[model samples]
Target: MKILITGGAGFIGSNFIHYWMKKYSQDEIVNLDKLTYAGNLSNLRIVENLPNYHFIKGDITDKKLLEKLFKKENFDLIVHFAAESHVDRSITDPDIFLKTNILGTHNLLCMALKNRTRFHHVSTDEVFGSLKKNDPAFNEKTPYDPRSPYSASKAASDHLVRAYFHTYELPITISNCSNNYGPFHFPEKLFPLFITNLLENKKIPLYGDGEAVRDWLYVEDHCRAIDTIIKKGKIGETYCIGGNSEKSNKEVTYKILALLDKNEKMIEFVKDRPGHDQRYAIDFSKIKNELGWEPSVSFEDGIKKTIDWFSTNKAWWKSIKNGKYKEYYDKQYANH
Candidate 1:
């Protein structure tokens, strides 16, 4: 099978590329990434020279580029992952999210319909909005109540995908996954930021009392879940994939501290971003019962593997930390 993976250089997308290539060496994979702040080609260094793996530097929002590439590649499947995904960035700048997530998805859908290619959308559980501490976990049927611009854009893209499925009979599957953490992760999100910060002996920023809860799905588990969905899942279905391991910010911070043999003094509590979701959890039973898939990595094991990766991959993330990302990091977490 020949597949096109949008945003394939980014964290989860790059991980998926590695996972797919390793599992199905016979299949051909093409990566389309815009090389944005979060997208790093270094993640795919191992497979860059492979015969079946190819990379293209482009944007999904460019309609002409999509047309030309779709015509040239004639791909059998397209996994949509490109987006301005950071909620804090979206809060400060929403135009790009609207254009990329909503409009870019529409562009891809048009091309997919034209080319008769099966499409799968990678989404987030944040689209279902925040959950109360006692609220039941989010499922496929949950109504979207996006609070942040990033989640709202993702919600819009989700609606668009379903619209194409129902109206144009587009063959598509969507998976809303929980928070992902693993190797090659850019040092901006929770796990990477904390781990790298500890490595630098810098204080890890703990947002708003360090109590917001999240289900931390290891990236490899997420990649496997997506593979299951594309290969065996029912078209037009949305699956919720999660780690089944829930942790609060404080709890997770303490875990990192313990792993690195550091104390709580390394943590710096800062003002939380607006619309910070109190909790997010997924009910992944649908995929589990139907597809026989569930997260295999325990949080205990996953965190250790992640820490080891960051420790050994200092050069990979060090370059990113030394670039423009450092400036953005400072401004984003200025309120302490």
Candidate 2:
């Protein structure tokens, strides 16, 4: 199969590309990415030279480029992962999120519709908004109540994918996944940020009371679920994937400290961002029962491996952490 993977240089996308190539050695993959701050070509360094792999530097919002690529590749499968995903970044500038997540997704759906391709839309559990302390995990039928611009845009995109599926008969599958943490993750996200910050002996910022809960999934496990869905999932269906490991913000921070032998004093409570969701958990039994997929990496093991990756790959995280990231960090944390 000839596949097109959007945002292939980003964290989960890059991980998925590696997973797909390993499992389907004969498939040709074309990775399209905007190379934003979060999308780094270095993440795909190992597979950059593989004959089955190709990379295109472009934005999903560029419909002309999308049309050209669609015409050229005639791709059979499209795994859409491109989006402006950070909640902080989204709060600071919502326009880009609206453009990338909403308009960008529409362009891809149009192209997929035209080409009659199998489209898999990667989404998030945040679209369902915050969960109460005793609330059940979010399932595929959960109502969307996006709290932030990032989640709102993702929710809109997910709706568009489903609309296309029902209205146009587009072969599409949508997967709303829980928080993912693993290698090749850009440091802006919580796991990578805390890991790299502690590695550098810099203060790890914890939001508010650090009691917000999130279900964490290892990136590889999420990637495997996506692969299974794309290959065997029923069209017009939604699948939820998760690690089934729920941790509070402080618990994850302390776990990282324990893993790195860092002191608890390094954790500095910071002001929580606007529209911060209190909790998010996914009920992914649908994916598990249908696709025989489940997370294999334990949270403890995953966090240890993640810390080890950052520690050994200092050059990797160091390069990204300097410059603009420092400025952003100071601005976001200066008050705290």
TM-score top scorer:
1
User: Model-by-model lDDT, in order?
Assistant: 0.95, 0.92
Point out where model 2 deviates above 4 Å: none
Query: Candidate 2 residues 192-285, lDDT tens each?
Result: 9999988778888889999999999989989989988988899999999999999999999999998888889999888888778999998989
In every candidate, how many clashes are there? 0, 0
RMSD of each: 0.7, 0.9
True-vs-predicted CA distance for residue 313, candidate 1, Å: 0.6
